[model samples]
Target: MKYFFFFLFCLLIGIISLTAQSLHFGYDISGNQELRILQYDDDSQSIPLPLNPEPVIIIPVPDGPIMYTATNGLEIYPNPVETELIIKWDTQIANLLVKIELSAYNAKLIEEVKFRASDQKAVLSMSQRPSGVYYVKIYCSDGRIINHSIIKK
Candidate 1:
């Protein structure tokens, strides 16, 4: 009976821990002076910031011919997106104006949107767009500009 109780206790603890959410911590290097924590709803994959002393996380330059970086705390995910694309940034710039431009490979402008930085995240729908390579340009009110290439399938 004691062994059974011990097993039940351990099982309960394991279940609780397994259901707990995980947080990712990283420093916002965009002169925002903010700490960003990323939370995911699902457990299929998680990319945590490296456990290092440096507060900034430097993403490797993309293999494409053109690459651009605007300070830090800027993240675009699910490269080669299917239907939707997510753009995330630090909350510190939430009050500033952010301009996002989407263009085709031939420099044909597709869509443009402007919003306050506080939104932090933007979900772009590509359902109507054709499957091809597109360019994303982010113009921040703080004189910061970032360019990235994305593929839609």
Candidate 2:
């Protein structure tokens, strides 16, 4: 009986797939900040299925330098972000410690991430957190410190 129900559920999903749409996010594999997109058809006979109708991005990823280093410079964009945030440096960094501090009327420690710098760029997701001013500090193994302020909404 359980197997029968499971089969029926999958069958229903398959029927729904005919009308569902699929979305694909483009990532730069060459380590450069270039965006390209490729999609598959629903009739694909592969073991793992792909997006049904293929996703169409209304906004395109603008071209620019994707990587940076701490020595050359440090920068943060779109000050306030919900899901993800990008950090760029101009020089090669070794040990990178990222600290996010929240300060509005008062300052408080929110989160901290210690990572080895790679590819000159890093993305952080902040789906959680309140709207306000955030201080992101980057500390390198060479004893250099860089800071950027972000606002979350």
Candidate 3:
């Protein structure tokens, strides 16, 4: 009987794959071990399958620098920095207090600077730092946070 149910479940999964829908399998957290199916119309959402299914979890891996920008008038360059890095913001945010933080890939704080955007620019010297991956976070007085990735060469 157990084998029959297993075969039936396999057949059911085969049929479900024929349709344009998504199947999410999960167990009930209350120890019920109930099977749940979630269907989605689009393929935007996905869950990585375990390699062996032995209670293994999948994690997102980074291939390269994870960079993100939130401000339009702000610029940081040149990436893969050699010695110095420059940050600039337009006059639109000139009156806001600006704070820049440079950190290592492990999220260790390296350096920080605070100034008014009216200064038009700020320079961070990376000449003394070793070549590696780093991150920069910007905090604005108006509650805006920006992030960028930097590579030291």
- Identify the leading candidate in terms of TM-score: 3
In the range 73-123, model 2's lDDT, one tens digit per residue, is 665665668877777555434334444233333546655653446555667
In the range 1-153, model 1's lDDT, one tens digit per residue, is 999999999999988776665675555667543343445557665655444446578876434332444556677778898988888888655554358888999989988965556678888888788899999887756666678999998
lDDT of 2 at 26: 46
Judging by lDDT against the true structure, name the best candidate: 3
Q: List the residue pairs that clash in candidate 1.
A: 94-117, 94-118
Worst 10 residues of 3 by lDDT: 61-70
After superposition, candidate 3 runs with Cα above 4 Å error? 1-71
Off by over 4 Å in 1: 1-71, 95-97
Go through the candidates in order and give each one's C-alpha lDDT.
0.73, 0.57, 0.76
Residue 105, model 3: lDDT of: 96
